[model samples]
Structure formats: C-alpha cells, structure tokens
Target: MKCEYDKDTESLKIELSEEIDMSTCKTLRNIMDGYIIKYSPKECVLDLEKVNFMDSSGLGLIMGRYNLIKMMNSKMTILNPGDYIKKILGMTELAKDVKII
Candidate 1:
C-alpha cells in the first residue's frame, strides 16, 4: 500500500497493491491511520485501480477508514475498484457507505 496526502486539496490518497489480505491489513491500517491523524484530510480516496483481489480483511479496512473519516466530518471514496473488488464492496454493502467512482 502507498499513501499520499495533498495539502492543497486536503485529500489523502491510498493506493493498494493487487492483493490485500490479513497479512498486510494491519500494517496498512497503521500507516493509513497515522497519515490521517497527521494530515486530517477532508477527503480520503482509496485507489483500488490496481487491486485485483481483496479478502474480508480488505473490507474491514475500508469500513474502518470510513468510520474514521466520518468521525472527522470527512468523506471517503473508493476510486476505480476492479470488478472483483467492486463486487465484494457491493456484497458487503460498503458501496453504500462510501462513494465509489
């Protein structure tokens, strides 16, 4: 996972690799949470364009971030998720909680 924050836009973009599972979820969460705390971005964008697979852990990650951003009165968006990822998001009803584009 990669994280980038734009001060001008007050947005934080997180780019995930092809796969996200339990092995990486904890680390990813720590890093993402740290960045959020440090920057306090108004918008959080999860770039899933490169992600082809994700497990339940990935869903948890998204939900966790969604709640975190909401607590700050910020918004979270899932960007360009692949078909598989999109389906999982839909199945988990996470698509309704966050904007997907």
Candidate 2:
C-alpha cells in the first residue's frame, strides 16, 4: 500500500495493491493506523482502484479504518473500488459507514 496525505484537504489517501489478503492487509493496517493517529486527518480515502482481488482481511481493514475514523470524529471513503470490491462492500453494507465512490 501507498499513503499520501493532503494537508489542504486534510485527507489521507491510501492506495491499496492489486491483491489484498491477510499478509498485505496486516501491514497496511499498521501503517494506516499510525498515519491516522499521527495526522488525524478529517477524511480518509482508501483507493481500491488497483485492487482486483480481496479477501476477508480486506474487509477487516476497511472496517478497522472506519472505526478509527469514527473515533476521531472524521470520515472515511472507499475510492474507485473495482466491481468485485464494490460488490463485496455492498454485500457487507459497509457503504453505510463509509462512502463508496
């Protein structure tokens, strides 16, 4: 995963990889957690544009980030998720908590 913070928008953009599974999600969660704690961005955008495959761990990561943002009184958005990822999010009803765009 790659992270970029925009001070102007107070948004942290996390670009996830093509495949998101247990191992990758773990590392990504850690990095994102730290960034959230440190910067306290008003909004977070998880860029799933490149993610063609995602397992349960990916859902976990999204939920965890949603909780984190909620705790900080912020917002989280899932950006550019592919069809498969979007369907998964829809099935899980995660869009209720985080915007999917």
Worst 10 residues of 2 by lDDT: 85-94
Candidate 1 regions with alpha-carbon error over 4 angstroms: none
In terms of lDDT, model 1 sits at: 0.88
Query: Candidate 2, which segments miss by more than 4 Å at Cα?
Result: none
**lDDT tens readout by residue for model 1, 5-74:** 8989999998888478999889888988998889989999999988877988999988998889999999
TM-score of each: 0.92, 0.91
Q: Model 2: per-residue lDDT, tens digit, 1-101? A: 78899999999988887588897887788888998898999998889888878988898889988988999999988889888778788877677878888
| Model 2: lDDT to the true structure | 0.86
Which consecutive 10 residues in model 1 have the weakest lDDT in total? 88-97
